[model samples]
Target: MKCKILPPKVLYHPVLPYKQLTSDNTHKLLFGLCRTCMNKISFKCKHIDDPTLNKHDKIHEIKRCKECKNIKNEKCIHSNEERVIVGTWSTIEIDKAIEKGYKLQKIYELEHFEKTSTDIFKLYVDTFMKYKQEASGCKCDPKYCKPDCENDKECKTKIQYIIDNAAYNLDIDKVKHNSGLRFIAKICLNNLWGHFGMRDNFTQKEYCFTLEHITKIVFNEKYKDISTMILDENIVLTEYKEKEEYSKPNPSVNVYIALFTTAHARLKLYELLDILQERVLYMDTDSCIYNDDGSEACKK
Candidate 1:
């Protein structure tokens, strides 16, 4: 008998669709799938028709298939509507200030406080000090002293002269003074009331006169007369009117008065209306159209 020799077995590699399987009894097989293309692949082992093939010979493991790696390269876009939102709330410091008896000043303070770092108490202190200095007429400086006064007639004479001048100038009798303290007090009170939305009923003339009086008292000086304060003839009242025709009525007459009054007049008008509304509704429960039950109530 002649000895038989087996020829080298040919290896076959097959590619299939994803999830496909291959079965062949003639060859040992190994399987793998590409992550990129998700394609199934099989490798045939050279040991064909061998019943005792090694278990490790049929195993193939991939850490990450090529398909998954490609997914990592693509960028993900998110909708703008789904983006995070940021918001802010008003600070409560002003509310606290109002609760602490600053209701009057709080109005203007709230209006202008954010624009400036200074507080209401600081403004009060400064105004008080300024008015005090103006009232006292003192230079706010210490008086100069003389040394070796016994032998110097010139020094003595100078000292006497200074004393006379100081006495005459500082005396209430010789110095013409206005009511500064009262004026400042009035200004502070008016400003506070105005901030609190109080209404003024004074006519334009009366209002201007009151303001001018307060100003004169505070600064101890006279301002221009109200007549002079009015617009001069050089400023044309109405250009649209013909030379032969009477001037058209100026709608800005009252507007100019209100402006000169520094908007306090208009604010006062609103405040008066508010007061009237409150007074008219006082003790009349049925006057409120919207009731607590969310139904319209009979007007009283």
Candidate 2:
């Protein structure tokens, strides 16, 4: 099916504004407030401002981060630092909380987790919109007109040579008839969404026989999450997770894209349900089951 709707280029942070929803304010927000907490746990160093501290080599540890603990300070520096686990909330939530007279204490501890105003998906939207316009016709530019263009005959015939030849003009009829083509197209669509939302870190396994190899992995300050299993006296299997900085994040994994894709899908689904009303018996992400009362409902 052809889709013309596109989601916003920028979006608020994924977290909901409130924890729970009630009948008094069911429609206060677009979606219901998240019932569960999505707090991200992170470690900060006390000597972050210290000029002598190796800021680049800060390692997160369980009780006390390794970098600050090793330093011989006059006082227990780590104890004085506000080592806090803060919840990442959307700007709307923060503002609402403040408006409701909830005093935000320790405001200095807050850090910007993500950019609120960035054209991160601008290139992606521009590329797709360009193709859409070319496959149709530019409102001002007539030289690149296509057969599917809603422009005049003069403009349509201008680019008649590449009407069906261009890569943008996909043969939907061929794909619909051919099972292989349909499968490939479906997989490609799903892969695009999944690829963008791919997880960055995964626990990796390492098998070592030497004490040096085992010690190197076990005592590495960079890897905060580590576990080891002694298969035998000579064999040791180590599973460890690399810190965010050390981890290789997927270049294309943008949460904004994935969120928009799903958001648009949900909106489309809701549109259909609104039309069907009580007829909608069941529905899923990509499938719908509604009662057809021998009318234009099914035809539509």
Candidate 3:
């Protein structure tokens, strides 16, 4: 079914102290002893000012100290890198583990599995809990909910009203599966990045190309001689361009190549190998060497 892609939501930074707290302004730090760990936690002057300090003392109450909150944020960001490195296990792992039930959890629990920082662990657990709750049709407790909770009847009603309006305005099913949705999202996201002039942590287009061009490149017979082109260990051409560029090229036919460094290329090669499996019968380290026949090589 044909689907119309919706415009992507403008990417915005979460409200942060770096943005909210202006430079050159002295913020009073309020110290508090943690009730549980007895560890000292400092809150920012704006949110947690010392009560003993005079009202006109120009003290700002901080919500949370940089030590507690900022470190947590940093660790959470680092956890993403760790997750990527620890490749996801297939369902087969879980299925096999199920045979032993809680014994598997016990064994793995005792083994010194690489531990993430507490803050990162909490963030992952919270996210998993949220998704589990959502999938199971369970409501999160207000006490445990994130700060952006709409608990009051009016706020809740407003949220539902907005959701209902959005549901009425857009085709939800089509939005979920639309092929052009990612392209539209990329354009919108890049536009937002340009508009806001945010350099770091914001979305950027690494590669952009039409589906027709991608399909042609993937299925093209002209690249069959690519195997002979790879000559040495250090040099492997991951890309190839036709000797003759197309005449009367379609506007959407241009290819924006994303070249990977040597290290990344090795990792990508392995990843592609895993995905292709048995279909990829033979893959020489430097080239795509097929065992079928030398006749196909001469044809190109």
Indicate which candidate wins on TM-score.
Answer: 2
Better of 2 and 3 by lDDT: 2
Ranking by lDDT: 2, 3, 1
Ranking by TM-score: 2, 3, 1
Please provide, for model 1 over 18-77, each residue's C-alpha lDDT reduced to its tens digit, 9 standing for 90 to 100: 232333323322211222221222323333333554654433212133443444343323
The runs of at least 3 residues in candidate 1 whose Cα sits more than 4 Å from the true structure, single-residue gaps closed, are 1-129, 136-189, 192-196, 199-300
**Model 3 over residues 254-292: C-alpha lDDT tens digits?**
121111122233444544443443445655434553334
Q: What TM-scores do the predictions have? A: 0.15, 0.42, 0.15
lDDT score, residue 59, model 2? 34
lDDT of each: 0.31, 0.50, 0.32
Q: Which candidate is the best by lDDT?
A: 2
Q: What tens-digit string does per-residue lDDT give for candidate 2 at 1-300?
A: 111111111222222222333323432232211222111112234544545546354332323545634432222222112212233443444444344333343443333456565566556544453344343332324344333443455544544534455545432221112334445545655776898878889788999999999899989988968999999999999999999888877798987566556656665675576567667788777888989986676667
